[model samples]
Target: MTWKTKVNSALEGITGYTIVRPRPQAPPPKDTPRPPADPKIDRLLRAPVFVLSPVRSGSTLLRVMLNSHSRIHAPHELHIRRIAVSLTTEPVRQAMDALGHSPSDIEHVLWDRMLHRELVASGKDIIVDKTPSNVFAHRRISTCWPDARFIFLMRHPASIAGSWHEADPQERPMEEAVRHTLQYMRYLQEARRRYDGLDLRYEALVDDPEGEMRRVCTYLGIGYEPGMIEYGRHDHGEFVKGIGDWRDKIRSGRVQRGRPLPAPEDVPEDLREVATAWGYLQES
Candidate 1:
């Protein structure tokens, strides 16, 4: 071999050794797209009423009462916020890719299984999805299913903040909690302002559940049932207390949940005004 040929071979050998082939370039993965989002899911199974509220706003009690009517199915928090709009257009393949699984894999089947379970549990034509956080996605839902009726639950601002603090002591940060509470309140108000003929209802359901539930059923154009009054008496598993942790929190006098909660009279003047507007008063 020529001297130059040997040098070139040596250089090539070094290059090949150093630049390890990127393990047989896998065929450029075809653009695996997600399957179309099911339209049925978007319309909430064609349910007439869709409840939207902030957390701990007596929605659970509302849900139970709604379910008491044979024609109504009030499922626990459906968490439709992620699925209703955000993931609706995602292709099945893309969804699986996002979930790190094959689109048709049986192992990752739990996603649909659980989601469908909740969907199926909402037994009536009027399925009530009692997710409080869904307030954030109201506009998105409007875009996705404009015909769906939205029933918004509004609580007294002070009690709402107090309920948050009571449920999770860590939920309080003074400024942050206050800001979030105000933001949520504003969001609900904006929904009411923007949507014409919106089925928004305001009530402290916990205070007079029987009366409130009857009104709710009446608004939704559904029959009322007395069974709703005793939802807590049933074996609801994890949802037993529903959002009643606040009762203890309020009784304990922790500002938030575990912290020191202010009395209705003791609430800051500004917050107190907000609470009063919503019909909440201190227990005299």
Candidate 2:
């Protein structure tokens, strides 16, 4: 017998137990075709709002303003997409299949129930989820909540890169910031092209908070409230790191103007196309 085998046998005899290695598990399938939502079995929340934007685009600011309204509850980044359901046993899988529920369908139900619970707890008529990464899963979100509404938030691409780097200079260098932030920009642009939603710019938001907020209220089919412009007066949960912007600027209570846009010539070549498409740059 092999030396390793003899050693293992000896250890088993001395210890009175054999080593048990876990079986390898296959990775779950991705992009499983989700059946269309059926009102009879689908969403618990009606017409939920999703704000799609790149990181450092002032979504936290918008969320706070929306939260200030009496009838609206704009919670911090609830990355519900990351919350997954696993079928741990054959019987569990068989039971779900018997109910005509695909793996994705079960996940959809879980996502909806969680959001609806949050909404009910807050006692708000509308719930807005402003997770920036939601742009990457925009199609899946649409499929999950067929009656969902979208709000596309835009910013100058160079400014977004600069802000992302500034948020943590040591952890997020300029080169990496540009590359990482660009991914979100591309996905957000794709969603904007495909979905019909209200578009708001960060620059415009800070420049005229009242006007922009009024427009948002109108779109959501609610009357504009003065409290929305004074977002600092209300409690908008915590400004924690992972959940949303945790910077002092967000904690300041009132709307502050955004940084000046980078010069057209200073815009990076990589971001020029998206900038031009977003109206921050003119095509040469």
Tens-place lDDT per residue, model 1, 119-158, is: 4764545666667766776665564455557787776676
Q: What does each candidate score in C-alpha RMSD?
A: 9.5, 4.3
lDDT to native, each model: 0.55, 0.91
Per-residue lDDT over 143-235 for candidate 2, one digit per residue giving the tens place of the 0 to 100 score: 888778999999999999999998889999998999999999999999999988999999999999999999999999999999998888999
Predicted model with the maximum lDDT: 2
Pairs clashing in candidate 2? Answer: none
Model 1 Cα displacement at 101 (Å)? 21
